[model samples]
Target: MFSIKSLHKIIFAISFTALFVVWQWYFVKSVFNFDFLARPILADGFCKDCNVILISLDNLRAKSLLCYGYEKNTAPNLCSFAGKSYLFKNVYTPSSKTQDSHFSIFTGLYPISHGMTVPFTSVLDSNIKTLPQILASNGYTTLFSGPKNDPHLPLDRGFERGFSYKDKGDEPRYWMDNMKKNNLLNRKFFAFLHTYRVHEPYIPQKENINKFYPGGPLIYVTRNDLCKKAYIKLLSQYPDRFKNLKVLNDDYCNIYRDYNTKYAATWNVEIESYLARLDPYWDAFNNLDFLVKKEYTHALYATSIYEMDLELKKFFNELENNKLLDKTIVVITADHGEEFFEHGGHSHAANLYNESIQVPLIIYIPKSKSQIVEKLASSVDIMPTILSILGIEAPEKITGIDLFSSKENKFVLAQHVTANLETIITLKWKLILNGDEKELFDLTSDPEEQIDLSIKNTNISNDLENKLNNYLFRLPKYNSIKSEPFPTWIDEEQRKKLIETGYF
Candidate 1:
């Protein structure tokens, strides 16, 4: 009953549907051959079949780990695993904050070069050369799953998958949850994991706190009550240091929160409201730290660290189980580090001190089994090294060095943003330059960065300043590197995350 044209149309529709099914089945996850989907095919044929996994722990300072120094067993499992890995003694983040630090991380350039200064509206460009792109361009599968700037899965960036916060969640719980949802809890490939539990108001539950502070009930006793007579009864039994009720008050005003007619200065951008806390402002942070420490027995802190430890055990086991362990490269580091009043700063985005810029870095080179390098290195170096190891030619524009393959690290760079242009760190010395003035520290003599030798070591200070000037001058300008603008529908959740982590 059908006309000739109608019959012809029906035949064409059936053929197209049949072709679509076959295309998906043969080309997608069902037959995910890395050479075609993610990475751009390349010549020289030296392909790294190695599964690359990069882990970034947020607000984690290197010194807190037993693997680094710290008397407390903060990262016992990490320490245990350090025996079989190459632990770098000193690794620096390029900036005191996450945006700038991560910029250096993703692009291999300094903030002075990459230009993502303020957290308000800064974004990393698409054209910027990132690690995932480099790996993907050389017949390797790439999965980028973090901040928006992460070099993966934007449909345009060539990631096999992109778990950017825009399309997915960014909480630490979401990371684990998503892994389970995707049935990737055990699947091994080039994966990057970022954690943020140690960040601010230090909100660890009281139960977790009890593990650390054994003397008290671990309850949030009001500051008013702590400064009153009743609690002082218990205090009187203790030493003179705890004698005066007012002494325990630890009261102070934070003007950073206050705005008045007396000051003529106006903010170009909205300043963050001052975060006020009780007398023991660090109660939350301590509890979280306890949770981190509890892994030895109760295993809260140790539990989280060791949870990753066991997850890693399963992870590595899966790799071995899947015949992929021998062919993998793993690098562990932090985006930015935490602050525990080392420099009178409770969190980051304050200054460029060791607590803010220094992070732990471990490179478990495949087959090498065990090695440690003491060279001063930057997070930016990881990308170049991976490219070099794979024998894939990295774009020459990168600012970082291949720490293992090259001996060129006489000095490195670190940055922070304010119109002041006040923050900087170098190999032997760390300095903060505000306009014409400077604050200097000799990191070699004082690793904790307590002693500021600006007046005493004026000569050395000047020398380092000159070195910084010449180096920065020679380095590429942030504006010079052209990059594709971020999407028009910008993700503000990422902005909120920056504020939450104190990047404001």
Candidate 2:
């Protein structure tokens, strides 16, 4: 009944439409990174009265947690929670420093965008809206608990903008007791709990330390102390190898000890006591093997993590006892991760490696089914995800997307501003650039990032480099406020504190 010429024309038209659709899909995906199969938002407004608890365990690496596949049961409570929560496997911080990473978490912007790229120096721009500000405006009481006089989260830097109450300590029990006393937990509230308990100068209880490290506290020196001893030993052993050999004499060591004594006088009682034990045995301490010291230091770090896990258990138990477990959404993550002689680095913020960037991200939503999410998430995504879960609108200028509804980011960017280092990571490849230096790693094959494939795989490396450059160039810059200059004594005290914390 159909004409042959008409049938041919119909077939040709159908073919042409199919070709156009294919071309459009490819063009949009390549040009704009369109995701055709993005998942819809799940359970919006499911917990309008739910309280939010954001817990940041400073310097906690994902690999050290049992939930993330660590061999030891370092975090039994977190592991159990992960079994019933959404565990994001590949979450990375935008920066390796405390202030920079936490700013990203609170503001939903990268360090470059938020203008806190330098640790303890660059302040957050006052114009930037934070997660706490948004939640507080929505009738949620906000509270903060962290270290007193924290240089990283200074009040002038906008950290104290939206909190109704703030505690200057890192004890969960104290915070819970205060909440009960004030009756703040009965109302809808957002509480941020931060602790350096897992951070270095790894000092756990003696029993906990002995569990992981059979070696006593004699071998447990701060990473900075160990580095100083190692340097002194290097000078003493290879005096002729250095141009300035005169400074390696016994009088020089005595002079250093005297200077430390003068400096310790300005510090608090606890740090002063710590310095007393550190300076007297430098010569004898330097005699320990570098490898042995490294082993013991790692053990101490593991022990500290284990103890922090116990504290977390107590905090959650109190929540359950108060009948608030089902009414709260708990998010546990870290500002950054710590490095243990990985890539010849002792601590963080000096490099953009995975050991310093990868952190744990666990979101516990009541009545939600537990699952592992393999999506690539950045610290910047945290605020948006929290707001999304609360059914609140995020700021219009935020660079992050909701982790639940949006497609996985094509690449995640990280920067170490002081180091002038930048990295771009995809699902399979990672490219790190420091000025003219470039290193590429196939993450799927070398998760440790030991192999540098930049030379052998120039095409892939160059492509990633181009993408990273484009991404950075497009980010909005903010006017960064510099922190006030500290007085000589205060400067010295903070310097000593940083040194003890292994930041030096």
Candidate 3:
């Protein structure tokens, strides 16, 4: 009755229609029942006397940790802790930047809601209720200890409220010293420790460097500080060679401005003219990528992770020796994850990819058995989760749900305000909307986000977009007064110092 080609075409059309209908039905059912799919409460609440110890490791990714299936012993101590703590398998940061992610964690609000997204300009509003302020009001002394020299993290930004001791260092000795000197261990306290050692310029000790890169090239054997020095000298000598090289401006010094002041002064040429005359040829300077892409880079990053783990191990041992571990809740997480050529770029604040937003969240509460929480969670959930664990009611303004609740939400939202990117990720799908461009990934099939199914799966894409918009609509307008912007702009003098430190 019909030609063979026509019959085949008819069959294909019917099959496609059936698949589309089935997919739409499945998507709707999953979105509605996602939270209930695996709704198991992992941990119990803590007593009122329990103290809190929060640790933030910068640029640490969930996949980098051995507990998360990394083959390397990058974080042995963390792995041990993970076995004894509630390891959140699907936790993400609200934003992929350091300052903005921390703001979301402390304030229990999204970046836009808190009015702190940019590092140089965004400041935490004083009117916003922060975790430390609330804990201090409830008779818990707050303490902050991290690098004292970073200009980006000043105490005036409302994060330092109720902080009795704010010191600097990546090591735990200084913090322990202060705790003993201030009689903090005897009191109910909330200590927040941030470490940048695991961040860029991965300057692990020589032992760690050698351990990771044994018998490797000396160029790769050097720590980040040394590598930075060499890279800086090389760039400084041939400033014209790297004029068009793509770089994160915040991570590096303004070399063009520096060269103009010093070299142009000697050459008697205008800075603008000198910069304009430099021919753009990044391909010729292929060594730049080579240096960063070498095995040494991976080794250095791994070594840093190991070194951070050792520090935490020592800190935890000290706490355990003092019997503090039995009475305190320890929360270890990161602001964001680093990327190594993932999605064609490195470091963070570039995309909403899993490599950039997914962070390790390990929470150890006293007298609680460890279990992995597979539900979707974000940085904003930390504040509310901590409050709930302490048996305190979260503020009405808090948008995050209790991660321990069986009724945890179906989806988690992550954003990058700088790139104008927003994402809505469920257990099965991730949809990223960047202006007019859209990318959809099926996490079950493509966890690497290598494929874009937006065009092929238009129904799923539209559904996720609608969900994202609905969630965004619930956010109250941010009305907090913004703080004065701090000066992080580089000048001629600042440029020289930044270069020596291997910045940029």
Candidate 4:
């Protein structure tokens, strides 16, 4: 009993619905390759079927790892795995921070090129091609696991879009559970695991509490308690300098909030006084002597690494049990290194010293020759190397080179936005330039970067400065939106968190 016009309208609606479904299915099939979704692809441009796993350790200095010549057994499991891996001894990251360094890793571009040099409110361009994006296009199921509360890392950026299964924590069980739920055992897969255990306010499990701090002067109380006491005392002295400051509790430490007034000299003065009070506790390591309470902090840092190593061992054992280790390519590296008053700085993202920029790069490929490569490498190289190994051609505009390529990288760059800093590292020399200040170190003689050779070696300083300037100019500028300006201000939640964790 419907009218002729109404019947025609219903027919049109049904036709439109059918067309939409067909288009959607076609899109999915083209993008995901539903026909051959389960097939695995080898890294040698063949179809032998292999899996790729990228594990990023946060705030882990190469000097702290036993594999990297540290006296401590912080990364024993990693050391054991390095026996069958290709270890790159001189690997550096593009940025001395987590957000930008990881971006440089996922994208084969430096921090300046990607326009994500700063964190909190920074957004990745939708058009940018990420590692997961490339892998997903090639019939690989992409997964991600990182810090639960770091919004700058996951959803705000486009990284989460390329991942099919992503968890909020760095623990391997979360990734394993997701993989199992998706039935990804036999399917091609790429997993990115990010762990921040070795980062600031280092608090480890109860069992590992006394492992490094046994009978130490500050072993009776938590490092966070002492740090908070100092910070509260400073706050009481200079309340005006700490305006808009708030406090947040991380899992390991009590983070003092950040503020716009953090740049004021008065605030720094009070903080310096507090640091002076705590210097004795930080001078436990005499080799790398600096005036800061590093013993308590470093002990906790080592314990965290030990805990993470235990989890890593467990993950490796699980893979072995499942017989998946033989077919998987495992990459282990860090976003950036930590500092223990190495250059009068306690944490990272403020300086570009070796202790802040140098990281450990261990690549383990199944049935491959294990050799230690001393060639210069950067975080940017990770993307190209991954793509090259996976039988995929890198993007045309990629700046990073393949790690296994015959050609050697002559120089690598690292940047930090706090001081508008730029650093250039060559085989023999390293130049760190901040505004009008320049510091040149002869790496061959001064590995610790303790000697400043800028005044004595003007020729070397000028040459490196020119190279850094030219390199930066070659990269793209920050241009997120044409209509709206780039967002430099961070939100309150992220700002507070960053400040608490010494990001500011």
User: What TM-score, computed on C-alpha atoms, does each candidate reach?
Assistant: 0.65, 0.82, 0.76, 0.75
The model with the greatest TM-score is 2
lDDT of 3 at 195: 80
Candidate numbers, best lDDT first, in rank order: 2, 4, 3, 1
**Model 4: which ten-residue window has the lowest total lDDT?**
251-260
RMSD of 3: 11.9
- The deviation in Å at residue 178 for candidate 4 is 2.8
Rank the candidate models, highest TM-score first: 2, 3, 4, 1
In the range 172-281, model 2's lDDT, one tens digit per residue, is 55668656655677799998888888765565776667776664665544444443553464446444533333434434444344433444433332233334334433
Q: In order, how many clashes per candidate?
A: 14, 0, 1, 3
lDDT of each candidate versus the true structure: 0.56, 0.76, 0.73, 0.74
lDDT string, candidate 4, 209-302, tens digits: 5777675434334565555665666568668855565576442123342432344322234234335234433333444434325666677788
Task: Output the TM-score of candidate 4.
Answer: 0.75
Best of the candidates, lDDT: 2
In model 3, which regions exceed 4 Å deviation?
1-45, 149-151, 221-295, 480-504
